[model samples]
Target: MPVEQAESLLASQFSIQHTYYRQHYPHGRFDIIMQGTKNIGRLYHDWSGDVVQLIDIALLSAYRGAGIGTRLMRAIVTEAARKHMRMQLYVEFDNPVRALYRTLGFAPAGENGIYELMHRDAMPFDEEAWASVRGLNNPFQ
Candidate 1:
């Protein structure tokens, strides 16, 4: 229950997850979310048949509300739109990020125990709409 022990356990869990993904999703992308010189989070996703599966995305506690996750999600949405593929992800029923996903056009598709499956259909990327989801003005508009 000590802080150090908890951190070590988390690191070990992450390592195990990374290894599992590497072996199972050989073609998937596992990206570190960087903020200038710091590694702030990670994103993992891959193609599942014709759908773009967002397997995981997590930010360090310090970076959770900084719009970084929103930006990364917008990029993924754009990519799925470009490929004309639906995007899907599973979120815990109580996760706050579920609101953001809904704002980005994902709808509740089903449920799996404690997780809810959400799906977003392929649509033309709307920069303005995405920006407004985080209450930001589109810089390029």
Candidate 2:
């Protein structure tokens, strides 16, 4: 598809999905992912149930592999564990970040077409892991 057509198709698809989501979860959050003063990405999530759905998370090319995404995901993992709720998201089947999700303890629940659905059950927070990521001796501080 041409760039213009692809953009138009994506916009249309997003509009349809956003409308459906708003109908089902009127209070869902659509957040802008920021780095300092720069607008880096967007995160759309629904936080209303026992299983929180991470609708989307995307960062620009310049921000990829910089540990910012890892931190964000770890925080999500911590929060979900704290709440005793599962976390779920879908990623393109060929996405390299699938490894990161696996490292974060997400397992493949299923797949459809080009997307893989992944789930992480609630578990005790890994304080040591979080600490290690932050270069701290303890995470409880």
Candidate 3:
């Protein structure tokens, strides 16, 4: 694929293959959060249509223990609920953030051992879909 096409495909498109996230790990997915123009905090979701992922809820170390993580997660959940979409994510067994996800209604799907897969039930969207999508205007440009 041409460089421009590939870049356009990644940045503005959503038809991603499922294997891309697991195989690509943080890069193929997390890169969005680090680099997306609208700074949606880069949501990493599966292209498989069965699962949606939220990875690298990353904030600076000094920012830990603050309410920032909670706010970020609540925003993500609100978006999912507004879209009537379910979300899934994994947290390492020893990772400190595991406790945070639990408060947001995410529980273990028990697929990856130490990494727990949690989800929020699908919901109806009143305006969630239109909220952040326009930020990527001219997706192919």
User: Candidate 3 — what's its lDDT?
Assistant: 0.56
Worst lDDT window (10 residues) for model 3? Answer: 132-141
lDDT tens digits by residue: candidate 3, 35-103: 233443334544235344565455445545656455556656666665566888878889877787777
Count of clashing residue pairs in every prediction: 0, 0, 3
Q: Comparing 1 and 2 by lDDT, which wins?
A: 1
lDDT of 1 at 87: 91
TM-scores of the candidates are 0.81, 0.75, 0.55
Name the runs in model 1 displaced over 4 angstroms. Answer: 1-4, 128-141
Which of 1 and 3 is the better model by TM-score? 1
User: In angstroms, how far off is 138's CA in candidate 2?
Assistant: 20
Alpha carbon lDDT of residue 111, candidate 2? 90
Pairs in steric clash, model 1: none
- Give the clashing residue pairs of candidate 3, or none: 33-42, 82-125, 84-123
Query: Residue pairs in steric clash, candidate 2?
Result: none
What order do candidates take by TM-score, descending?
A: 1, 2, 3
lDDT of 3 at 14: 40
